[model samples]
Target: MSAAAVAEQDGRTGPLERPAGRTCRLCGSNQLRRFLDLGVVPRCELFLTPEAVAAPDVSYPLQVWVCERCLLVQLPPLFTPEETFTDYPYFSSYSTSRVEQARTLVEDAVRRLGLGLDSFVVEVGSNDGYLLQHLVRRWIRCLGIEPSVNVGETAREKGAPTFTEFLTAETGALVRAIHGPADLVIANYVYGDVPDVTDFTRGLRSLVADDGWASIEVQHLLTLVERTEFDTIYHEHFQYFTLLTGQRALATGGLSVVDVELVDIRGGAIRIWARPTECAMEPSVRVTEVLAAEEAAGLHVARGHDGFAEAVSRVRDDLVSFLIEARRAGKKVVGYGASGNGNTLLNYCGVRPDLLAYTVDRNPYKHGRYTPGTRIPVHAPERIAADRPDYVLVLPWNLRAELLDQLSYVREWGGKLVFPIPELEVVSPAPADRPLEHPVF
Candidate 1:
């Protein structure tokens, strides 16, 4: 989810509206404490066109609470899958880096799992068949289970056969009828977004072959708080998982982690490889180490909510001051990446077009559209070269390295790019100078 404040066009859920007192969605803890109240925010994915900007829009509460019971951080309930996914507009192929990552992951799965021509691959939330497109190249058989009609249709059009519906136990049975069993399954970034983790994993179990493996990538919870990734908290992401909690969730669904890989992609990510408990792949020492660390930190204990609330306040104030100071200096500042994280950052900080000129995104669908709430217009990356502003404010700071490399020309005229959250800083490259190392946090 790119940081931005807009409604997710697919089937978005409705607000919980159960009058505050919410038990922790993960561990059944009533000791839930409120930390950040982003007011009512629209789905962060729903970018409005310039014309639609004039129309009134819907908004929902974006409050986040930490469960003392499970140390699980989550947003207050808002929007159902029907409201979020049914009309989803996001296409996975929009990002080159994402496509590359998908391709690489598919390759790794094939090699690690000994997948061959006879193997079957099933993907959950497989938008536009981004990874399947590569799997097909290897002459592998594949099926994509996508809930969104628009994206599923595109995946089918791309030649990877698809089921244009969400994966559930029922859907899994239907897929089993047609595809038999999948030798490999992928749930990249899907597990956390799903509310019914048990059902979703049940569907996965039904689809996977008896000895097959499934790889799920989720944002590592430790990394989220350690890095001050408040922007990652949004309505769509249901449960933040560390290896400890994730293993528990998977075990409940009759799966076990056989291996784990910490990836730098998506800020910080963990790709867990799992199979039936009968499978004998040895769990890595890293797994126990991570689980132990989480236990010591009381991830399952309900306490320390107030400290997090204070941290949220500190981050919010610092971000606001950074943007305000930049604007007061008469510097021309624009945002980079209109992703959902950027939206949460902007809205939470109360930033509007008054501070940022506009946002730049590589995704064409967002270009020329207005960011929800702030009315900041989204434009193509070329706008940076053409406009050549004094400063560029990066919303998806996790990708600052990639964006900086891509927009190195900003240094041609001494233009520097700014990072907001975590901390604020500028990167100015001399025309003939090599890349500079960002100050290590």
Candidate 2:
């Protein structure tokens, strides 16, 4: 069967009717070339109870394709936004580093935009109002639009004026009617989650003042391929963007890229500063330079997506092999951080409790639950010291530095750290007898 037919059969259409073919979401092109397939996996966030874990969980094909015409890499929506985001479990405030990053961005935006009490700031997908809390503290007028009722209520309790509704073009108009057009709109790491990119950008354009700007951050596709960060691919993330694809996606709503900032957060993300085409701002030279780099790296062609499957396969093999060896050697191996991406990696590698005894998470909500698909028990970080596993596999490799420091006590028991991305390697502690030549992983 054709991809389009399969998608239609699976009930993947958005509110608007997609073109007949499996068209590109950005440019409406009919040329989408499939590249990497991660096989079928369960929803990343479906933490199950011991009773539910024994029952079969739903799974969907986790295949990715790049649009030949627009270079937008995306996965077909196997599940709807309402099915994925409503009553969401992932909260942004759980990570101190992430909260600090949001604060820094809010401070920078305030200083750069000359925001004051009169200025209005609106954020889409504002999870628990992590960023809006900073704006409220400055006594600035701000609002948060979040679809998840649980998180939105938490945001309201935190004193951020939040509306529990998805930001569609219609909702954007309503916001403008009541709150007025915002001086600045912020969408952090959410552009990939929406199924309708055009509608989401149109909503941004509708909500922001003509002279105001919208800042969006998305995981860089280049980094995904280069670092083999396939674990980031889950059902919740519908699209991936290079600078070229991002510009095209935004331009669909008459927004133009004004500036670009490469951030180290989320393994390598691009923060795009965009303004309506009517807002007379020149595009930054950095935008041109980044596009040049992408073109030079052949990101404009399908061949750039080649070899990604092989790279992912190698990581899967090496990680499984390492865990098997550790088990055979009678060493206890446990995972740290029961994150969504970690679930993807574990499910893809077929790692179960036999290979990895359990995983620990700092998030209280995830603690005492079992990871989706793998059924690995999730425990509090305190369990790690009590258990003193021989090897702690750090699942969220992007936050390795923070996790390693927080878990430094593991070294006291001669425990080693293991990371599964880029390559699977066991990081040994620095010898106490000599000064370390490199930072401890």
Worst 10-residue lDDT window for candidate 2 reads: 432-441
lDDT for residue 405 in candidate 1, whole number 0-100: 72
Q: Which is the leading candidate under lDDT?
A: 2
In model 2, which residue pairs have backbone atoms overlapping below 3 Å?
Answer: none
| Deviation of model 2 at 395, angstroms | 1.1
TM-scores for the candidates: 0.88, 0.92
Which ten residues in a row are the worst by lDDT in model 1? 10-19
TM-score of candidate 2 against the unseen true structure: 0.92
**How much does each candidate deviate from the true structure in C-alpha RMSD?**
7.4, 5.8
Cα lDDT tens digits for candidate 2, 1-441:
965576568553212122245877777787777767888989999898767877998988888878767778888877789987789888898777888999999999989899998999999999998899999999999999999998899999999999998888889989999989999999998899998999988889999898898999999988888889999999999999999889988998889998999999878899999998998488889999888878887788765666678889999998888888778779899989989999999999999999999999888888778998889999999998999889888999888666767778888897888888877757754443222222122
Tell me the lDDT of model 2 at 400: 63
Off by over 4 Å in 1: 1-21, 24-29, 280-282, 296-300, 304-306, 429-441
